[model samples]
Target: MMALYNGDEKDIREFFRVYCNFFKEQGYDVVTFEACIGMIMPGAGALGDSRVIPVIQEEDDFRNYPWDDIPELYFKEYSKYFRALREEMPEGMKAIGGVGNGIFECVQDLTSFQGLCYIAADDEELYHNLFKK
Candidate 1:
């Protein structure tokens, strides 16, 4: 399985081409393409800055976070790559959808692993609300 981060359509297509070819050369019969739905909160990997590590500084930050206001560009770019990949998919290959971070995982991303434990104990309501969002 290979996961692709956000990029222009051209770059994404080129990557798929190379990726499929490499696997074919290695005698693999199938390839999986993975892409994420944009997350509401930031984290250490993929969606957030690697240098900064954790994007959310505090638990309170989650209270008023914009859960549904993802920018148009995210979906636009994602659709572009998704369509391209499907159109360019090689014969006998299968495509798989990538589910981004789940409720628990997103919370861990917003708060660190340690912080999540603290929040879960400190406010059960807030923890549940996180999942509700």
Candidate 2:
């Protein structure tokens, strides 16, 4: 099995390295898709401007940060970035896309972890709603 990401190469490689190292510690050899395609910096989005307070840094440094306060352009640019990444994936490899068991992490990134746990426990409908969104 191989894992690939659409973000910074260092973070992606670190994730894969830790993933493989954990499995290898128990005896297994794995090849990551990033390793298959020699990457160094990868790509990142610039969804900040004067109107927006550069929520990316806040989102990265803080949890349960209010993203609803961000401008719609930020989300629009981010969605465009994601769409571009989706389009860039090899057609044969589309079916393999996902964070494996990290669905909750994806949700947290989309929403927030504190909100996610509440939705997971108190509002299944809203949880799935945000998840599909």
Give me the candidate number with maximum lDDT. 1
The global C-alpha lDDT for each of the candidates, from Candidate 1 onward, is 0.60, 0.39
Look at candidate 2 and give me any clashing residue pairs.
Answer: none
In TM-score terms, candidate 1 sits at 0.64
Off by over 4 Å in 2: 1-30, 34-101, 131-133
Lowest lDDT block of 10, candidate 2: 36-45
lDDT of model 2 at position 8: 64
- Best candidate, TM-score: 1
| Model 1 error, position 66 (Å) | 0.7
Show the lowest summed lDDT stretch of 10 residues, model 1: 40-49
lDDT of 1 by residue, 46-107 (tens): 22433444444445666556655544544654666667767667788766654455656655
Instruction: Report the lDDT of model 2 for residue 124.
Output: 69
What's the TM-score of every candidate structure? 0.64, 0.27
